[model samples]
Every structure is written in structure tokens, then in C-alpha cells.
Target: MPKKKKITPNPSGSQLHAQRISELMLEKKALDIKIIDVRNITTLTDFFVICTSESEPQSRAITDHVNLTMKTEGHASWHTEGYQYLDWVLVDFVNIVVHIFSKTAREYYEFERLWADGTITEVQDEV
Candidate 1:
């Protein structure tokens, strides 16, 4: 039997990084931005930024905007996944995990329900 790998929490830049990701998502007009504080629930990641783009193109745009903006602002993701499908894109920045999903896919995943125990904060979109 293979041993399961444990995910260590990265305390450095957790909040700041998550905040920046959320801000970028908002700037890109990602709808219903949500910040989930899963620090107490899981050690894998401190925070989860879940937001929905109107369509696949917008989903890609949101992810791209986040990547470019964060990198330009002196932060870069350690790993990114799900770009091929463009339905759900994940940008992992160690402590902060950003999820840019299409409307239908976002509803299907129901990440908010999966992490219901965690503190879920709704990020208001200015526009």
C-alpha cells in the first residue's frame, strides 16, 4: 500500500496572496467572487478564491489576468492546472489557490458546498 502524502501549510504570504488573487478576479469581472478560509478545515491550502466567469473565454481571461497581474506585482503561481479544458482553471500560489470556473462547471463543482464548514466570505464586485 502506498502512503498518502500530507500537505504542509505555507504560512508565508497566505492572506496577502489570497487577497491579491481575489482582487485580480474582481478586476477581471469574475462574478460571485468567494473567499474560503479553509485553514482550520484543511492543511493543503490556507485559502480558496472561487469565482465564476461568464464563459470559457472569460474563464481563460480571468485566469490570464490573475497570472499576469500577480506576476507583474511580484507574485507568481507555483503551479497552474486545468487550462486545456478552460471550464475550470486553477492557479496555485502555494498558500493561495485561485479557481476560475465557467458558470455551469462552477455550479457542478459546488466547491462552496464541499467546503461548507470553512469560513466563506463573499467578495463584492464593484462593477
Candidate 2:
């Protein structure tokens, strides 16, 4: 019988980014935060940090804070979308992409279900 190799989870750069984004989401009182590791399944991006906000203003605020915080750490967003409406603001950081959505928008899109192939890490809300 062949022995199976045990996989040890090592925290990579993208994982660290995901953790930071998760913390930021909690700090901003964003709900239902999840960090999806898509490295093994896709080459497009490494991680997806998704969160939900109660209101449009809160969604915008979360996105703004994430952008500002990450920028201070020498990482800038590659591209941003949906900031004007604040329904679903996507802040792309190349390796890590953040999706801040309103409750309705989040339920509509269902990113968690969409990216089910990736390993999911649920970030507990501290606020």
C-alpha cells in the first residue's frame, strides 16, 4: 500500500494579504467575511476576500479603508470597479482581490458559492 503525503498549510504572501483584509473587514464591521484561496484552482488571482455591508455607504467605507490600509503597506490596487454605486465595490490588488458588497448585492452574486472550488477560510467578526 502507498502512503499518502500529508499537506502542511503554510501561510503564503497571498494568505497574509487575505488575513489583513479579513481583519480590516472586521474592523469596519463588515459581516460574513470569507477568505477564499484560489491558488491551486486558478492562475488569475491567489485570494479573494469577500465581505458584506449593511448599507451602500458602509460598503464604500470598507473599500476605502482597505485601499488606504493596503496602500500604506506599499501595495496599491491594480484596478477598482463599482465605487460609484457602492453596491459591489471590487478592489483589486493583483494577488488579492477584495469584494465589498451590500447585503442584497452579496446575496445576488453569491461569490462564496461561485468560488466553491477554492479553500475557504471564514473570518470571524470582532465587531
Candidate 3:
């Protein structure tokens, strides 16, 4: 039997959407921003955009901005959750899932570590 071929992350594939989501999150001052390229590992989504929110209000703002901006840009989220508590608001866009978490929640969950197999990239906060 032939050996299985490893799938490598493609920079040009579905990354535009993920980067746009990351920018949207940054618009609301999301902290510790990261983009996990999970295409090589899972079919769940091409990418996972994760960030830490300084407060509940900030978390809500980030979620709202991402959803609204994406909608206006001609891409709407398939589903959303965690808005009531704002501990971890998720906006799913079929191609990507944006996770806005509180500091405690981010530390507790360790999403990046969990997706260690994927190519995790840290997005620099705009000055």
C-alpha cells in the first residue's frame, strides 16, 4: 500500500475570508488575535479566528461587527452563539468560525494549543 499524503495548509485558499474576520475582530480591539489554519486537519472549517475580549461589552462589539460587516460584504454567518453571556461568542460563516473570548475563557480553553496540528498564526494588533 502507498503511504498517505500529508495535506499542507494552502495560503491562498479560504484565507481571505479568515483574514477579513480577523480584521473585523481587530476593529473592535480584540486581543491576542490568532488565525488557526485547520484546513489540513479538519473539514469543520478552513480556519478558526480566535481572539480575547477585554470585557463583555467588547466581546459583543466584536461579534456584532464581524456579523454585520460580513453581511454587508456579501457573506453572512451560518450561525452564532454565546451572546447572552459573552464568555465566548462564536460567529460561524461556513468557511470560518470567529471566536471572541474573554481573558479567562481564552486562557481556560486554550484553543490554539488544542489545534496545535494546524498552522497557528498570531495577528499583530494595529497601532
TM-score of 3: 0.88
Write the residue-wise lDDT of candidate 1 on 21-92 in tens digits: 888888878899988989998999999999988988888888889999888988878899999999889999
TM-score-based ranking, best first?
2, 3, 1
Give a tens-digit lDDT track for model 3, residues 1-127: 9999999977664698889888888888888999998989999998999999999989988998999998999998999999999998888888798899999999999888899999999999667
Task: Identify the runs in model 1 with alpha carbons over 4 angstroms from their true place.
Answer: 1-12
Q: What range of 10 consecutive residues in model 1 has the weakest lDDT sum?
A: 9-18
Instruction: In angstroms, give how far residue 39 of model 1 lies from its true place.
Output: 0.7
| lDDT against true structure, model 3 | 0.90
Cα lDDT, all candidates: 0.87, 0.90, 0.90
41: Cα error in model 3, Å: 0.5
Which regions of candidate 3 deviate over 4 angstroms? 1-13
What residue pairs are clashing in model 2?
A: none
What TM-score does each of the candidates earn?
0.86, 0.90, 0.88
